[model samples]
Target: MSQPQAAVGAAVPRVDARLRVTGRAKYAADNSPDGVVHAVIVDSSVGRGRVTGIDTRAAEGQTGVLKVISHLNAPELPPVEGGFPPGEPLRPFQDDRVRFFGQPVAVVLATTLEVAQHAASLVEVAYDAEPVSTDISVADPADEPETYARGDADGALDSAPVRLDLTYRMARNHHNPIEPAGIVARWDGDRLTVWEKTQDVQGTVATLSGEFGIPPDRVRVISPFVGGGFGSAARAWVHSVIAALAAREVKRPVKLVLTRRQLYFGVGYRPAYEYDLRLGASRQGRLTASAHDIRTENSRYERHSEGVLQPGRMLYSTPNVRQAYRHVPLDVSTPWFMRGPGYSTASYAIESAMDELAHELSLDPLKLRLRNEPADDESSGRPFSTRRLRECYLAGAREFGWHRRNPKPRSTRDGDWLIGMGMAAGVYDTERSEAHASVRLDADGTALVQSSASDMGPGTATSMTQVASDALGLTMRQVTFRLGDSLMPPAPGHHGSRTMASVGSAVQDGCDKLREQAISLAVRDEDSPLYGADAADIVVRGGRLYVKDEPTRGETYQRLLARNNRSHLEAIGSYAGASESEKFSFYAYAATFAEVAVDARLGLVRVRRMVGVYDAARIINPRLADSQAIGAMTGGIGQALLEHTVTDHRDGRIVNANLADYLVPTHADMPDMKAIYIEGEDYEADPIGVKGLGEIVIVGVAPAIANAVFNATGRRIRELPITPEALL
Candidate 1:
């Protein structure tokens, strides 16, 4: 009989889809321990101040209010060992100083969530306010910038035949996931267990252990499901610490969930950016030199930085390049990664500048990008492992019907709507980290795999199951994948799109080892049908081992294991990660196209359709890949037209903290979207040959829409969101 089809390349439905749709999957806040109590935090009103007094008498008098804890009565936490970025992480109730407007000052515990919320409001606080610097435009950047220079950018810009100078501003964005940040902490003696909504369970365990000064093994983090993270849940925020601390103090399980408004200040956000770009190119669209000066916001106490300067340095073949990235301190919470992160932000400026150059030179936007494609990574001076960007562009152009577009601005029009088409290129680094997985093949001919990696809605379990099934020569139904428990084999946090390349490789290794062990036992057994067969010549399909040349001589794994009297075969698989001395520059590439309709009179812009073609090596599951690309495109729509976190600088307050005021893309706003992936693999990049698909999908989306808007209305709106006021 012919061998069964492999499960790796098939479009399999998510393994947990049934559980998710039926409300059987337990989220972080879904768990309520036997004696769980509720805790609510009281936020500071002043932007910058010292707590003069905190009156908890009224809160203490309320019925069901167990205690109101603040700096005065709260126990001191041990010094944390290591924190994110490079500064002091916010410690809940550690001192009287209020660094930001919504800094948590006190927590109230009660028998019910309603009582805790009511009592938290009754707790009074007085502060000595100080003048705060909350504005990024007016604030001074760091005196010494992080700078990179290869050739004389200034001299080259002066001598180039064509040049363009542009400045763009982007609004700060929040990760408003459907599930708010929450934690349920229960301590028994010196050991602790927490059910948290987080992207990294092991990262949470480490943070909690460091704060409580306990061994790492003493803290257990269980997170089976995460509604959505988008980088907000990557780290253990201050709310998590507060919940654990309260549970320890009260000697009972404590559950703390941030309100929708509190999410604005409680968790991390994408920092706003002010980017000034200067480009010098030949008249024929050959890039010669570029200079980028970027300024972004961070907290006064801690500094947060990202890869905003990377794309500026190496996206195209520029001989001379200069970059200076600086952080402006503000009296606000420190920013963190959101979706595409720095690469997406930089692409907005670089890709927009390229489009502007194309308009100036009277060339097709796609052709202009093709003219400047780099042979190798200029920044690192290394050849790319697999750069299919040219293929991506060609595929996108054909699928998007680039030839039908009218190059002239304001040239295509329907009834009261000016139609325009535009496109941009995007790039993101292919990052990998060390990971491990545990695999076991039971005597009953089934397999179980476990890892500590998280699945923040990317269908990680499904993808891993596919890999394991293919490697073990078993049907998809015979393999099961489990994740999100700290006790499992170690793996990196589920961010940066590294889960598939790193964790998937580990699973493949474990399954392959276990299969080889079974083959060895079968080849050596006297009673087995393939007893004398060469192990190297043996292949397995549907749990049956047979010789490659002679298919009839085979034995079922069930019979082979029973003859050996073995209960199970197990192995620990590991991936040492990317090479320290890397030979090639690795990155994922995308070409995004957009068609938009602009109403000049009403200053409104609506996207009609979008097409994105990507070079994310070797898709494991087409269904999951399409979901990631489409979801990211939707986020791109929000970034381009709706999402913005408004702040009132006068008091450092987020003016539009709730969803009603802060806008996002509803189902009504989404238009036709299509995502296409180039087929093939890049073995040089990783063992699994996947370059990561999540972040690159959103990288160039905003610029494509912006370019389309310009084409429709002949207006160069440098700022984001393409608001009506700007168009008018």
Candidate 2:
């Protein structure tokens, strides 16, 4: 914004990229403390049953076996209260009930990794087998679905000349990163220290402190280096607690890393959804009414529901609308947030139904979407803080050759493939949270900044540093930034794409205050050349303050401090969300274009190219933001074409628990992906004039790909992960 300065809008490489790429960065598993004991978690065999007996005699007799802990022999712990932003506390080994498969039943401690592995197999468990009802054939969610309505949808649909009624099913997906979940916990009397793999270090500390009944200060969670989280590490799952408790029970430091298979059950996932959508529109593509019936799965112990009805109520300008969201409480593990959890699943249904409407009315898909863009967020009746969805649609269409696309299915072909192009609108809520930061300026003309925000491999630390540099009039090398420790300045947990908006603003705040502190000291001192100058008229460039009309009248901050006998100066700044979000409207929007080629004989669908255009407030780092968007598109392709977490309903066990059985996008499947960010700031959203982009990037991806498939083939698949069998 300021002539491409180091602040706000810049393409700066990550501050820690060298450490990460040089193999010098230390992840949690890389930490090896003296006298560290190895640990292994024994999981439940039966999906729904109670452990009647645990054979630990063999494990205890083996060499180097420190301890074997089960609910029968484990220590009494605090209760768990579950939900986000410090959900219910976690009590790992407090009970004997087996709620789902892969629930940790026992933890074995040994002197060596091999010894722990051998001893874990020796400690056996026998359970009373119960019926496993993990079937997805017919999702029978719980009673009393949450319902919302604004107008009479039934009456509008009855009077409309065009209508549609269709159902969509979404497959379960997992966030499998290269690094598995691990925790190294050490107990020093009543205090505990844990080097964990997590997204929210402060949240983990709070959960562990509450679970163990220890004071918050007694627990320290350090996660400087994380491979990748998606949403798996948002909270401290049961594995972390089990490892910490094992350390307390054994009187030694213990390290526990969940096996890849255990990851499917230990943490959370994107739950399966079954949605029935009904729509009414005019013959000219004007939407009149809509109805949505959504059902998603949750564990019996916890009542969780993804907000799949949000899109239907707001995306288009539909006057008559009714929606109900129901949760099916199955005997499965609790599901948590995944990338674009609600928006992705909901858009698939809404956009697919729109595609159906386009076919019936003989209208272009892009034209149909444009005809329905709401003048405002209809549900809230508030003007958007900013909306560039129209621009995205225009730009993406031009770049992807949308004008050349044939509306007729199976009309375009090249060699052994049928080529087609499709586009869909994507939307997501922006992030807003209370965040704080501290900045300290040393007399040597260098600056140090600290915050509680985290970098979940999206280059948050680097971006924050760049913001601090320009605000303080310092180079990137002159500023040192730190994160991922609870001891740093207090900040909200990083999620919802709010990190940059909230934390980056906080860093800017701190730097501004620090710079002001130096300027105030200089203006008040007669020894300084800028003595008695008005603070408003003084502008500091690279640590040297000068007057508005006279450049030679001011002196460097180093001289003012040296004459004042000061060693350093510091300031703490805080950023909070404004009340305007409630008074006005706020949402980030994107439009995606996808081109695909499907083999007519073998049903092999390969994407040729894809592009995403976003109106996500202001981008902090262009390069990193571009990468985030492209990676999100690639992930969406996986969700549309390959990703599925299969469960063996016969026994209520996840069958495709490992990478081999499950599928994700590899380099071979990657297409030529591109991203374009509209430049500007939404001042009503935050002080930093930015909105969130991470979650929205993937929201409309699956639908975009599905629409392209429909354009390529005459058939329209209703379900997700559209397999080759369906096409054949």
Candidate 3:
């Protein structure tokens, strides 16, 4: 089939937008099977302790309460097999130990949700509390620090003409989606089916089956729609297992929805970080060496780490580089991946330091970055697949009027407010995973595609449908894409910006196979108009198969299939993995510019305008890509000025767990924002040539805002959520 230029790059409307906007999309909590009951979890109040005794008699006696299960009465579950950190996963209600505050201690199942909640409140638990350490500053490192060194960092720092030593802290942040994590589990004659809110339906099936010691085929997971993920729902949390066990014990389907307060504990959050950095540079602002000492928060049971040191190791051309990453186990739950994950956190520190270096050398920040750009990945000694970051900078500078701003701090003032512009460079590793999809072409000249991927607000269904439509030589209306079910073709988790490159590739592969099948049938049919035409000369367009040189000699797919007595043609699409020749480093790059106004007297910082120029290869839909950029910039504004998850060290409890206390960016806080994509494609990245966009957009944003604040006020705050108090 000849590739069409229209659908792939066009700004097509989301195919599922109507279903989502009209409230017709079915989320996990919307699924309710016959004879369903509600389950409520009872959490411990202590930060660190052991359940000494439990009194569940009152809860069991409550009306409609079917069972009150605690560690004392809960059935034993098989050990969880595999996880990211390579540790035994946490099992609910299987042990007396309480590793953190708000840990689920018991569950109450009843005929109604209200009764279950009321009965859960009646269940009493006794605990022997221990001194809790939630403070990163006071906690001891759980193990030896992980270290990486490239050259003689100490010698280079000592001999450099200029030096800087800085310490930066980022507060923990939570993923508070409007739709809370929920699960509805049912078991029929040893077969388990769960409707759970998750990014990976297939992974959930495997996890639940492993926990229950059942074959994978016996477990099915369905999550047709998800409200939002942002990485919190990437894995099946402990509550999912609790819900399934409760349903089995009750012998009926059970529904469990986490309350707002419970969400703060049940789902994962971005971990707090303390980064100590030392940089040595030449008088021209070229970096000579960088030494990073990083400390992060994690639970005592499982060590959680991200790619925190990656930015320092490979972002620039430093010859002497060293890194030490340590996890300080605290009385808190294990942190999971959030949007941008490690790269965003690391970018704030590195990019802010870069801005400082620019100031010290009296150089434009963009020019200083350009001077130090690496020709290859210094850490791995590999050439880049494609790096258009310089182009992004040029485009952004031209469009954003970057040259008009005065480089001197506190130079431009209007009344009580100071105006300044700042920019930062952003990078994220291009990631791809193996995935599979199934495509079918019906005699009616329509196509159906299926994959067990997710659409967590990135327009996965719409983009994939466009790809399928173009590849199958059909109109947008002739294609239907289905996802979020374990029974469909297998796909990796939809986090890490891999859904497009992985699942989309599979969809393309499937459509290509199906198109080939149709072409074979058409060429072999003696009654076809172009019966003697070579298969290579055939081109399918608008459901019509014709010889490339003779457009008029063609027949509709419907007629061809009907004459052949075929109902439909089907094929399985597969992406094996990244190519073996991928010796080149792959990443998506961006240049983020921010204009901010600061009130010196009131210590108020407000972003006035923002522009993001990105070099993410091959944007499937410009409209959806812009949405991703704008949303990420908004999140960066929050991270720089508002968002913080406060913990009370005395009890290890989250102080501002609710929306009212925790702040995010709202309409008033949104600045005049624009996003521009650099024109390009990286076929080495994937068949679709997309390096991914969701995470990279947010990577350098916080630092850009921070640098702008410094340029306005002449004061730098190394801590995140740079509050007015910090400026004062």
Which candidate number has the best lDDT?
1
The lowest-lDDT stretch of 10 consecutive residues in candidate 2 is: 82-91
TM-score per prediction, in order, is: 0.99, 0.97, 0.99
Please give, for residues 1-728, the per-residue lDDT of candidate 1 as tens digits: 22334998799999999999999999999999999999999999989989999999999999999989899999999887457777899998989999998999999999999999999999999999998888999999878789999899999999999999999999999999999999999999999999999898888998999988999999999998999989999999999999999999999999999999999998889999999999999999999999999999999888888889999888899999999999999999889999989999999999999999999999998889999999999999999999999999999999999999998999999888999898999999898989999999888999899999998899999999999988888998999999999999989999998999999989988887888888899888999998878888888889888898888999888898888898889999999889999999999999999999988589788889999999999999999999999899899988988888888888899999999988988888888999999998988978878988999999999999999998998888999877888888
User: Which lDDT values do the candidates have, in the order given?
Assistant: 0.92, 0.85, 0.91
Give the Å shift of residue 261 in candidate 3.
1.3
> Who is ahead in lDDT, 1 or 2?
1
- Model 2 steric clash pairs: 80-89, 81-88, 81-89, 82-88, 83-87, 83-88, 141-328
> lDDT tens string, model 2, 1-728?
12125555778788899999999998888888888999998888889988899999999999999988998888888664554533233357677788888888998899999998999999889999888777655657777888988889989998988989899999988989888989999999999999999888888988899788889999988888788888888888888988889888888888989889988998789888888999999989999999898888887777756657778888899999999898887768888888887888999999889888998999999899999998898898888888888888998888888989899999999998998787888888886888899999888888889987777778888888888888887778888999878888877767778788888889988888888888889888888888888887877666677886797888876777788888989999789854643767888888999999999998889988999999997888899898799889989998999999888786788989999989999999999999998878898898778888789999899989999999999879988898888899
| Model 2 stretches with alpha carbons more than 4 Å out | 1-4, 80-90, 578-581
Runs of candidate 3 with Cα error greater than 4 angstroms are: 579-581
Ranking by lDDT: 1, 3, 2
Cα misplacement distance, residue 429 of candidate 3 (Å): 1.0
Residue 246 shift from truth in candidate 2, angstroms = 1.1
